[model samples]
Structure formats: C-alpha cells, structure tokens
Target: MNKKYLQNFYNQYKVFDFLHTIRQCGIISFWIFLSVLFTTSSSLLVQEYPGKVRQYTHTIEFDYVNWTFDAFWQKFLQSSIRLEDYLPEKQPSGIVREYLRSVRQISQLESQINVIYADPKITDKVAAAKSYQLQLDQFNAYKKQLAPYAESTLQSQISTILSENGLTLIGQPIPPVLYHSTPLPMALIVSPRNKIQQDANISLLADMTAGDMAALEDEVMKNLNVSALVVPIGGVGIYPTMVMSTSDLSFLAETVAHEWTHNFLTLRPLGINYETNSDLRTINETTASIVGTEIGKQVLKRYYPDLLPPESEISTQDTTSDTSNPQATEPEPFNFRREMHTTRVQVDKLLAENKIDAAETYMEQRRQFFWDNGYMIRRLNQAYFAFYGAYADTPGGAAGTDPVGPMVRALRKQSSSLAAFLNQISMVTSFDQLTRMVDNPPAG
Candidate 1:
C-alpha cells in the first residue's frame, strides 16, 4: 500500500502484462490445437478403468473445460481493466481487507439462512429466508465488484515474495501468480479395498449435497469394488488455479501459494512424474506444501504483519510450565498429528496383513474418536487415507511411517536456502533418486 510500492508495481505491471499477453496467446493456440487433436483421438485413447469410472460419474462430474474457459475469460477481462493500476495509493490493501470481511459477512448470512430454513417452528420459512437473501445479495454483489482488485493485489504481493525468494524467470514468476477463489469442486477418491493407494481421483460437481456425495460414494464402492470417499479440497492445481473461497487470510495466502507451487513444478521432472507413482505424488505435494507455507508467511510478514501468528502460537513446546507444581500437570492436549500418525500406522499394518475388514472397522472407530474430539471426519477408510496421506509437508500425520516425507524433509534441511532446495528436488524423477540424494549429501 506504500506510494512508492504502488508506483513500482504500476511500472512493472505494464511490462509483465505485455509479456503475459503474448505468452497466453501462444498457449491458447496450442491448447486449441490440442483440443482438435484430442477430439479426434479421444475414443481410441480411453482407458478401461477410467472409462468405467466415468460411466458411473458422467452425469454428475464437473465440466473442467467449460469452467476453465470461463475462468480464463474472466481473468483476461480483469487483466484488461487493470483494476489495481487505477486504485488510489493505500486503497489496494484496504480493498483486500474489505473483500475478506465481506466474505465473512456472507458466510454468516448463509448460516442464518440455513438456520431459518431448518427451524420447524418457523412457519413462514419463505418470508424469513427472503430477508436474509436480500442481505446476502448485497454482500455478494459487493464481493463480486471487489474480487478482481483483491485478487490482483494478493497476486502481486505473492509474486513479489516469490521473486525475492528466487522463484522467477526473467524477473517474473512463470504463469504469473494467478488464482481465482470460488466454490471448489469435491474430489472423489478411489482406492483398492486391500491397499491405501489412490487409484483414481475424479472431480465432482461443487454443489452436490452431503447426501448426494454419500450416495455417489456408495454407488462407486458397490459397483467398482473399491474404497471411495468424496473429500472437499482447498485448491486445485489447474492453470489460473482454482482455490476455495475463504475468509481466513492465512489459509487464502497459503492455498494460493500452494497451487502456484504445483504450477511451478508442472514444468519440471518432479511434477511431470507426479502421477508415475505414489512416491512422486507425495514428493510433489510435500514440496508444494513447504514452499507454499514459507512464501505465505513471507507475504504476511511484509504486507500484513498483524495477521502473523504470535511466536507463542507458532512454538510447539509448552513454555507455560509450572515447575513448582510439576506433579500436578494438566492432561496433555489432543495431538491430531500424533493420533493420526498412530491411526495411519495401525491401518497400514492391518492392510499389510490383508485384514481389509478389520482395517475399515478400526478406521471407523478412529473416525468416531476424532469426531468426538471435534474433528468432524465424515468417513474414514482406505480412500480417505489414500487421498489425504499424500500431503506429507509436516512430520507424523496421515503419512504414517512413509520414508519419502522424511527424506524430503531431510533434503530441505540439507539445502542452504529454499530456492536451493526447490532447484535440487524439482529435477528428481523418482523416490530412489530422492533417497540417494538424501543419503549422500553434497560435500561442502
């Protein structure tokens, strides 16, 4: 929001905008060509497994092509307007703050509306809903008006941090730090009953109700003989990344950076082989998680220091110790990571011994325990672990006893800087290579 920062941004925007325009043109042309080629060859390339999955989900699946086209067009229009350039100095930050506030208000209104509709005592439900709907409409319109500028402001902030951290090409982040926060589609994860591996992950319609999701999962499981769970995600790694709408600035920043990191890796070997095996997928996700959190923190430190978590909150140690009454210590807080790590380890052991039914029953019991302790996990099964387990950014969670995560963390520890870590890991194509790299550190 500084005057000098705004001026510099305006100056850089012009050059970067021109370059992006040219680059996007070529990319669009290439995609158009591919569309034509794929349309002709689509029938021949359909695989048996995915084809069968599609047969069950074809009616309810999300239309990514149409969504991407609309999103790209909206971004193209936003770029043309150059909303941030026209904003008064110091207004950009305020715009983002107001946008998030508006989102929170909207969320509150939605909750009120839901309560009104759900209350059986409210005889005039329609009338009650109308009052909240009018307020919701106003906030929605205000959010829509402010969205472009807010997005542009955040993008610039993130891009600046990324550039400073040495994640740049020709002084700019490739793909240009673009993201659009909206309602995100739920992913239906499928895995074999005997193992905890994600065999298929399909995107479903965003507006599907919980009952609808359950029904679909049931159908998939019954027909495919696989474990299935529909999970809501924070973001997707498509170009112009799709992020979930949220009022939490920290979460917003981290998710934006996370998806952007995915885009960054897509051009390199590690990302290219993301789907080659479970290890690579874990590597890709863990790497993105690390970069995203660090960059998100930097963005907050520079732009919104007040939002940063206090040192006490960030620290893991219980510094508020009462040494005088050490014998009368309170019960330790429920550690989700440690508990989840235990669950994953036990589940792995059960599945390894081919005790599929027992593993599932155990997961259900664990799910109930988590739910009782305020973690509302709808379903806990092989597919749930298969999907959530890939993000091994931090130690001892759903990753269980997996060595890949620790190896990646070790590599991060060995590298001199964040950029150095990314550069070395981005070129890795397999888990064996990652193991070798971790085992044999570079001589100083």
Candidate 2:
C-alpha cells in the first residue's frame, strides 16, 4: 500500500475514534446535528440485505462512574494482605503454583454449578447447591494465600520472557502486575447493516444492554486507565489486568505475555499510536499474537511441560489440541485454520467487488461447511470478520491476506533466534519500517 492510502486508512480510523469518543462520553447531544455527528449518512447502510437488518443506535442513559479509591480499599480490606505486601519477585514460588491450581479447581466447580443450575430436571437443587458451596468454600480459602503472590508471579514470568527475548522492560518502578477483571462482552459495530468496517466499536461493561442505549453508549469510551476499543483482552498492560481465574493455564500464560508486550511497546511509537493507525493496530496485535504464543509455549516448556501441546499436535500446528495431558483418545483431526483462511480470501474479494448479498450468502455456506467439519460458528457475518480479522499473524479467520502479518512472519524466519527476531521487530515503528526490514536484511 502507498503512503497516501495508508494515511487515508489511518484518517478514517482517526475520524471514527474522534466522533465515537464524543458519542460515548455523552457529549454528542451538546453538538449540532447529533445524528450526523454520531453516524455516517452512507447509502450503503440503507441498501437491501437478504436478512432483516437490526439497526442499533448508540445512546448513553447514564455516564459510567468508575470505582473510586474507597471502592478499591473496600475490596482490598476484604483480603488478608495489603496492596504493598506483594514485593517484586524474580520467579513464581510454590504458593503461586498452588494458587493457580486452586483457581482452576474453583473455575471447574463454578462451571459445574452453572450447568447444574441450568438443568431443569435437577429436583434437589438445595442439596446440590450446598454440596457445591462446600467444595467452593474449600477452594475459596486459598484467596488469602493467592492475593499477595498472584500478580508478582505473573509479572515475573512476563518480565523474564521479555528479557530472554532481548527486549528491555520500559519505565516502571516494578514489573507490571496482573489483576483479574470481570469478563465483559464487547459490542462490535459494523456498517452496511451486516458488513464489518475497520472503525466503529464501543465496549461498555459487558452487562450493559446495547438495546437500551442510544448510539452514544455503543461508542468506545476513552478515559483514564481504560481503552474500551481493545476487545477480548485477557490481560492489559496499563494498570495491569489479567484473567487470573482461567482454567486453561496455557491461555492464561499467553494473555499474561500478550498484555506485557503492550506495556513494553507503549513507550515505542507503534504502540503509542496504536489506536489512531489501523495498520499499526494490526501490527501491534499480530506482534503480540506471535510473541504471546511463543512465551506461552516457553512457560509451559519450563514450568508445566505436561501442559505443552503434544508432538503430534505441535507438528500439525493445530492450536485446538489437548495440551493438558497425553491422552489415550486421539483428538479427531480438524484443520479449521486452512478453511478459515480460504473463507477470508473469498469473502474479501466479494466485498471488494461490492457484492454484499453474494458475500453474505457465501459466508453462511462457509459457516455451514465449517460446522460440518466440527467447528460450530454461530453468526459468521461481517462483524465476526471485523473483530477476528485483525490478528493476521495467525493464518486463521480474516487475517489471511493482511500483508503486515506475512511481513512479520517473514522477519521471524530471517532472524537467527527468538531474541534477535523480537529485538528486530520491536524497533519497527511503522508499516513501512516492517516492509523495508523484511525486504532487506542487516549484515550478521
């Protein structure tokens, strides 16, 4: 892509972010032509679709009040340890390992509890509830043991991985910590009724109803210590958030590393302007995707070898493998990556030619084909692609054709080691830098 085209793409995102910010912050009403300010009058949205269009106008009934210091104190006071008690650690201790195991148990029990509660046939609800509560109580006792060490343990691992990979930790008195956030469902806004545009997204707390809110609430709220534009974040670099309760340790490790990369890159230009530039956003995501996966694999190899993907599965590079143990029952072979890649290329071409109806039809057919192959994808529309297409480093889904992904992957191949690869890529501040570096190699 030419510099002008890249600039145009970035400008589109910048416009959306600016307008969307006004909408989300409940300030658009104060401006003239509220509808025009909030939404584009593009004729594409009004065009006919094969299915009924569900129009969603963003609104903000009430401004979200962030939890104050008193709220933090209240939660902290509930814990046995003080916030300052967790000293920076070089490695995770036995307590960290035990805490993680307990967390896994709790997650499993909680999932079972949900299933039992949902089952209509279970007549002895009270008895089952009591039994589950007892088990939960046993696990919950570890919260005291967990509080002080959880963040430090995760931070240590992230720091060690980055250090090993030849990247310096940015300006911070201590390694970044991880706090488990409440899982929130992020709202994705797409244009053309069903087509996913690169811009237009707002993430409120997952519990907030998009139906009730006008066009304003659906806008991505930008404020202190929050970037609602980034979705499905298991971990965050700023203010250090992590999904500590995930039963899947490998995924948890990946998220820990992923968020750390964001923190590490924040001082660099690429991450600093991540939201404003679409290609930079993709580069950031794809970079983190690659680094995070490698870090996850490294963590498993060193600490939890049993959690590593089996040789058979690793050879195939099918991420959906059972990494927990070497099981007797062989996993049924399914290559969703290759199929999804093909789907993306085909869908992109259709959308490029302005064949919206044909594109939607093709997506549905492809979705069914995937389902028959043991992948259940519910509602594979433009929004699905829009959200998933960003991670181009991974071959699956809508990221197949993204030139940045291939360039980064090529850089990895040319580098002599993991550290060298990361060091070279970390210096990249722009899309052009990536292209130039990939095209020309430095003397060894």
- The window of 10 residues in a row where model 2 has the poorest summed lDDT is 220-229
Clash pairs (backbone) in predicted model 1: none
Report each candidate's C-alpha RMSD, comma-separated, in the order given: 4.9, 14.8
Model number with the top TM-score? 1
For residues 1-444, what per-residue lDDT tens digits would candidate 2 score against the true structure?
A: 124533444455443466656653443232113223212211122232212122332232111113222223333332322222333232344545676778778888888898888889998876878888788888887654564455545555566666665555363312233344335334443434234445544333444443433333234222111111223435434323334356567888887777666655655667666665567777888888888888878877866777787888666764434446766577666677767878888888888888877987998999899889888775566656666777776555577577777788788888887667766776777889899998889987
lDDT of 2 at 291: 80
User: Which ranges in model 2 have alpha carbons more than 4 Å from their true place?
Assistant: 1-93, 144-147, 169-196, 207-233, 318-332, 416-420, 427-429
* Per-residue lDDT value at 94 in model 2: 51
**Tens-place lDDT digits, model 1, residues 1-444:** 235644665666665577877976776675445333322222222232377677888777776667666777777666655667777777877889999999999999999999998999999998989989999999999999788889988998899999999989888887578788989988888899999998888778899999998998899899989999999999987767789999999899999999988877877899777778899999999999989989999988988898998878765521223236667657766777778888999999999999999999999999999999999999999998898899887877888998888889899999988989998999999999999999998999
Model 2 accuracy (lDDT, Cα): 0.57
Please report, as a residue range, the 10-residue window in candidate 1 with the lowest summed lDDT: 37-46
lDDT of 1: 0.83
